[model samples]
Target: MDMGIEINTRFGRLGINTTDALIDIKSRMPVVEARSKPPRVRIDTQHVQVSIDQKQCFAEVGLKPADVFAKEMAQKSRSKGLKAIADIARKGDTLARVDKNPNAIPALAKGVMGKRLDYTVAALPRSRPRVSFSGGVDINWDMGYVQLRAATSRPEITATRAGVDVYILQKAAVDIKYTRDGFDTTI
Candidate 1:
């Protein structure tokens, strides 16, 4: 009852034709109160995008430093110790490609609007907080179904470099199919 087309942009993976693999992780944030306003705690919703990378099937998710988990790092000694699990995950193995361009700020949008384009990148790191790149997906079509033959991954970043880890890899995909509800030719 389920079918799908997959595109492995190397660093991250994309799923077409179905939405069975999407996941959302929510965390309780701290409560901020103003002198005259009521206290409201922040909430984080991390969207997990699955990717087919590396040699093994791996996952890539995130947690902010000020969130509940990070806030209780000292108290949740057991939870903090379990972070080793992520250490065991090879770079490209899990959850498709997480924040391909950790600093590149992949335009949140990817399309040629006539002669212009608009996009967004992952949120930048702040003084003491970070964000998870969960809802990182875009889609387009020429008419019918579109499948990716190649993978276009985001560029990873570091203090000394940008776009070093990710690049315009290659012709990640090739082919286009347009589905129609036309009558079948009787044999």
Candidate 2:
């Protein structure tokens, strides 16, 4: 009971007539678009300095130069890793061109948005702690939250970096039909 129209073009010769009936089609469909957030890095120093209203005297506590170096290395690793991921995601999105090539959509979903985006950590120096990007979708889309964070059970500082996200919108479509005298179309 499936029916369709066949139109001929330079690619090949074809024919369409009343026997080949056009079936019900979409007036509109959802198109997906993506926006990316900039990569980020963070550090938490567990010390707070207090100051008086008028004046305050500063005091020094024990310092660990190695810890400072480690922090810098960790931040650098995270920032660079995220930046690389964002670039890859951008490339994948561009290649997908979801509006034009539907076939590329699945590749974009699996390669850029999945664990592949988190590959930078494997090459980072040992001083940096591992980070992971976990994804989730919500039935109520507005309530969804996506983020990146440390991969440890007990992280001193919880970090969140926003990555690219895709959403959909409906668009109008055109319908075509033929009459005995001529053709009619509506948008």
Candidate 3:
């Protein structure tokens, strides 16, 4: 009989692992905003004014007493002189005849007629009516105006981006095994 030996063996294979790359992006849209304030205004005004004066008018128009009496006396004296002259002319009398007449000449003024005569006259006081006027006025004025103001504001925006990452999920492994076979003889 012939004897024989056999051997069995197995080899493990290497394993590979892979993962896909990842990327992330974040963004914000551009924004536009506007704001405004209403205009502010103010105004001012002044009233009209006036003034008048009349003192001077009163002083000029007023009248006093003694002036009236003097005017009356002058008119009376003129009339008396005219009457005496007319009587003498109507009678056809000469100055010599008048001197001779006892009734015509007064004892107190007999010699004084041919000479200068002087006399003093007195008058009474009284008020008279008169017309007068005066007037004056003053005026003032002021102008008005307005004031105004305004304001405004601007807009804002933001954006962001993230990085990519890659990693393995499992590791590769290998295993080896061997077995031997032999023939046996018995006594």
C-alpha lDDT of all candidate models, in order: 0.42, 0.49, 0.48
Q: Which pairs clash (backbone N, Cα, C closer than 3 Å) in model 3?
A: none
lDDT by residue (1-187, candidate 3, tens digit) is 3444444444444455555444544445544454545454444434434443433343344432456556766787888888768756745454557767766556335544566669866432222334344343334333443444434333333333343444444444444444335544653
Candidate 3 deviant stretches above 4 angstroms = 1-65, 92-139, 153-187
lDDT of 2 by residue, 77-169 (tens): 999999999878887776867778766766666765667334333422224333434433323223334455433333244444444443334
Q: Tell how far residue 81 is off in model 1, in angstroms.
A: 59
Regions more than 4 Å wrong, model 2: 1-65, 74-78, 81-85, 88-96, 112-187
Tens-place lDDT per residue, model 1, 87-122, is 445333432454555532233222112345588775
Best by lDDT: 2
Name the regions of candidate 1 deviating beyond 4 angstroms.
Answer: 1-35, 54-187
lDDT of 3: 0.48
